[model samples]
Structure formats: structure tokens, C-alpha cells
Target: MRNLQGWEIFVLLAVVVLLFGAKRLPDTARGLGRSLRIFKAETKGLREDDAKDATKDTTVTTAAAEPVVVEPRPIESGVAQAPAAGAHAVHRDAADR
Candidate 1:
């Protein structure tokens, strides 16, 4: 597509002025500018937050570079293991009698 010529730009501005009126045009433009500024600021903040998150992820990965090996601890005397199914039935019958 070809670029907009000066005449096209002028016509578009004239149409906008006619549609919105001269009085409301400045207020509309100001509101549009404010919206753009707020949008830019939010996007910039999001980019900064994303950068921080990226650094955090990198540091976390590097810090845990070596694979961690965790050995299971032996069961203590105070903690009892569950009995076998057959043993449970026998125990239940013995208790009932």
C-alpha cells in the first residue's frame, strides 16, 4: 500500500473535526494521550517484571545446578508400619473373640 499524502491527511483531520466538533476535539485528544501514557507505563512495568523473573529463574537454576540426592531415612520405633492383609484379618478375629 502507498503512504498517505498531505491532502489525505488534511481530509482525514477535517472529517474528524466535523464529527467530533472543535470544542470536544481537545478533550478527546487529551484523554487519548493520557490513555497512551498509561498503556506505555503498564507495558514498561510488565517488561521490567518479566526481566526480574527471568533473572530469578536463571539464579535458581544455577544455584541448583547439581542434582540433589536425598536418601530415605530409616523408620523410627515410634512409627509403626501397617500389617499385611492376612495378618490384619487374623488380628481382627483374635480381637473379636
Candidate 2:
């Protein structure tokens, strides 16, 4: 296979424009750009989530090594009680990264 040059790309685009009409070309281009942007955002979000998950797995192993069973505190009136500070705090620490 051969690499396409600038002129070749220009000619290809011109042919596409002629086939699709000048008015529809802008709309098609805009749609293509939006699709690309969405794809990039989704891919980046997945990568970050995977990294965060890997960190959590490592932290889980760390927590497993430390023998602890923290309990929940009593809630005041309408507020919900948070988990006790020992092992629960470690999970939060891993996720924050």
C-alpha cells in the first residue's frame, strides 16, 4: 500500500464534497468531530477508572494483611453514621488517589 499525499487527500475530499453536496458537508464534518470528541472522552474516562480500580485492588490486599474489623458509629437524629475509622479509612485513602 502507498501513503496518501496532501493533494491526494484534497482530491478525495473534493470528490466527497461533490457527491454529498456543499451544504451537507459541513453537517457531516460537525457530526464526525462530535463523534470523535465523545470517543476520546469515553476512552479517557475508562483509562482513569481502570487505574483507580487497580489502586483499590492493591489497597484491598494491604487492608487484608492488617487484622481489623471496624464498626459503624451511632447516628445523630436524621444523619447517617459513618463507618469506624480504622479499616474503612484505608479504603477511602486508596480511592482518593
Candidate 3:
């Protein structure tokens, strides 16, 4: 779009004044300014967060990671027993009732 001339800008402002009235113009402008300021701050915070994430993504760790070893605990019983599915369903139904 072409840049508006001074007269066009003046006419636009005059139209706005006519539409919203002179009394409400300052309040409207103040609200618009506050919204823009808040929007700017949020965008700046997002950019900083993205920059931090980008840096974190590019970093190389020199330390060699150790492999995890998990030891299993022995059961008290010599044989392992699995519960029946029907028994579980029956227990749940009884509890619900």
C-alpha cells in the first residue's frame, strides 16, 4: 500500500473523532498504547525463550554418559502367580455396586 499523505492522515483522524467523539479518543489511544506495549513485551519474552532453546539445542556435552544398571529383587514365593482377569472384573464390579 502507498503511504498516506498528511491530508489523508488528518482526514482519517477527523473521521475517527467524529465516530468516537473527542471525549473518548484519549482513553481509546491510551488503551491501544497499553495493548501494543503488552504485545511487544510478550513477543520479546518469546524471542528470548526461543534463543535460549536454540543455544541449548546446539550445545555438545563432553562428558561420557554412564549406562544404567537395574538389579531385580527376588520374590518371597518360589513360583510367580498371575491373577485372573475375570477375578479382577468381578472385584471391580463389586466395588462399583
Reference-based TM-score of each model:
0.57, 0.52, 0.55
Task: Give me the candidate number with maximum lDDT.
Answer: 2
Summarize candidate 3's per-residue lDDT along 19-67 as a digit string, tens digits. 9999999999999999999999999999999998987867666754444
Clash pairs for candidate 1: none
Evaluate model 1: give its lDDT: 0.76
Q: Candidate 1 — which residues are off by over 4 angstroms?
A: 57-97
lDDT of each: 0.76, 0.79, 0.77
Ranking of all candidate structures by their lDDT, best first: 2, 3, 1
True-vs-predicted CA distance for residue 59, candidate 2, Å: 8.0
Model 3 per-residue lDDT at 40 = 100
Where does candidate 1 have its weakest 10-residue lDDT segment?
A: 88-97
Q: How close is candidate 2 to the true structure, as a TM-score?
A: 0.52
What candidate 3 gets wrong by more than 4 Å, as runs, is 57-97
What is the C-alpha lDDT profile of model 2 across 18-86, one tens digit per residue? 999999998999999999999999999999999988777453333334434565566789887665546
lDDT per residue for candidate 1 within 1-78, as digits (tens), equals 999999999999999999999999999999999999999999999999999887774533323233334444455787
- lDDT, candidate 2, equals 0.79
